[model samples]
Target: MKDTSMPELRAMCFADLNNAVKIIQAHDEDDGEAAEADYRDAGFDNQYVLEVDGNIVGVTGYRDVPGTDQCHWLSWTYLQQSSQGQGLGKGMLLELIEKLRSENARKIFVKVSDYEDPELGKIYQQALQVYQGVGFKEEVVSNDFYDEGENQIILGLYLRDDEDQLEEDPAVSEEKPIIRFDGLFEIAETDGAYTFSWIVKETKKLFGKRNFSVGDLQVGLESVKNEGGRKVFLTFPSNLPLIHSPLQTAGFKYVGQLQNYYEHGVHEYHFTHDLNDL
Candidate 1:
């Protein structure tokens, strides 16, 4: 490469979309196209790119966690394969952290999957190490989150001093079957259609496993179908066996499960309702 200008971090622009996605695709071919669509729909507000001499080499950003006080989930952060081993990633991320601190963001979290390639080995380990080195603590781990044997690890970093922070102790933590359906929410909308998700929580036995009925599911689906939504999705831990009959009766179809998602031997079950079929 010729004498390029110094690397600089700046807000991503519409023109930088193609280059940024290319950087992401170079790292993981499967994720590039969907990620690009996400940016177009979500708009490029806090998203940024690392540029050198007018060329984009890296891209990273964060998405706000709804209902939380300035909580955020880190977005697709990737650099060109040729740029690996350099301290550029560290510098870029630190600047982003400082930027979030300046914006008074409370906390940030990132979810990474442990996928090992047959030849390349663990693909996401470097990124995980980088996050840990920057003060992000382990929040949770879901075995087989992506697929069979591929686990997901979530890490969080406090951006501001707060009193309500967590002091989690795994040993003392008792499982609670407190199930709550926070209502129907749209997760992805594209191609003139929307895909929404519902997550079932563990309902305590005292409250009765029949806390919800087919009518509730039908009501939520009716509300979304009338609003131009195309598909409604739902997921729950397979260990919660009581939820099966009720959901099946509500016209929801069982899709599949991610083994060991909630804990060892337990899995996450997926159910979906398609409005077009109705």
Candidate 2:
């Protein structure tokens, strides 16, 4: 096992972006905009680092796609080979899940390559054990998803509401039940505070993908003349990057910026369109 006892957990920033770049480069061959895009798309608030004696030895990040009703997606997690066997990956995964749960996330997803190579195969098997141990269930597969011609296995885990925990744990009363939104916000009140809170909660719950944050509102819920307006919330895949132009074509427009939006301390490009404008 690695010397995990000396590792520190902290949020990432632009200054530390180069560290993430190195991690990506070491693990994958991405360069230039591809690497920078990964950092920007990762959101400052959604990325994290595991440091040992002041050097980043591990990285993990979450993302939220804009149109997918702010579904949380797991971007990626990586640890240096020197730190591989010390249970740091499990610890990091737990930290990410717990943080998302507190932020009101309902599901988490990750993609791991399943290859035939003995060495790479062991890595995938270990990753599978880590995710499954944490409650992830196999959900889907993308044929030939990796450069090595490996298939990608997608896994999913559901987040039980706090009230569900109370009932199942037998440690508290069931009267004070926790509430979760079931796609009802479209017709709900549109106070700035509520919208802001919803944005935060939604973003938190839907980390690990690019569409995790709302970039530009194609149509404010208010602008949707009918249920057609609500489809924007469902466009998120819960585990992939966000596509901006579709929402733009739908009617959403640019708004402003949200600073330090996720736990990763990243800024978000906010957008809004008035119902009246439609």
User: Which pairs of residues clash in candidate 1, taking residues 3 or more apart in a chain or in different chains?
Assistant: 177-202
TM-scores, all models, native as reference: 0.63, 0.52
* Candidate lDDT (C-alpha), each: 0.71, 0.54
* Model 2 clashes, total count: 31
Error of 2 at 62 (Å): 0.7
> How would you encode candidate 1's per-residue C-alpha lDDT over 96-188 as one tens digit per residue?
898899998877878787889999999999999999988887766644445446666777787867543434312223333535455665553
Report residue 114 deviation for candidate 1 (angstroms). Answer: 0.1
- Each prediction's total of clashing residue pairs, residues at least 3 apart in sequence or on different chains, is 1, 31
Q: In terms of TM-score, how similar is model 1 to the real structure?
A: 0.63
Predict model 1's lDDT versus the native.
0.71
Candidate 2 residues 37-127, lDDT tens each? 7677656878888887788887787887554333466765777767788888888888777778777775566767676655554445777
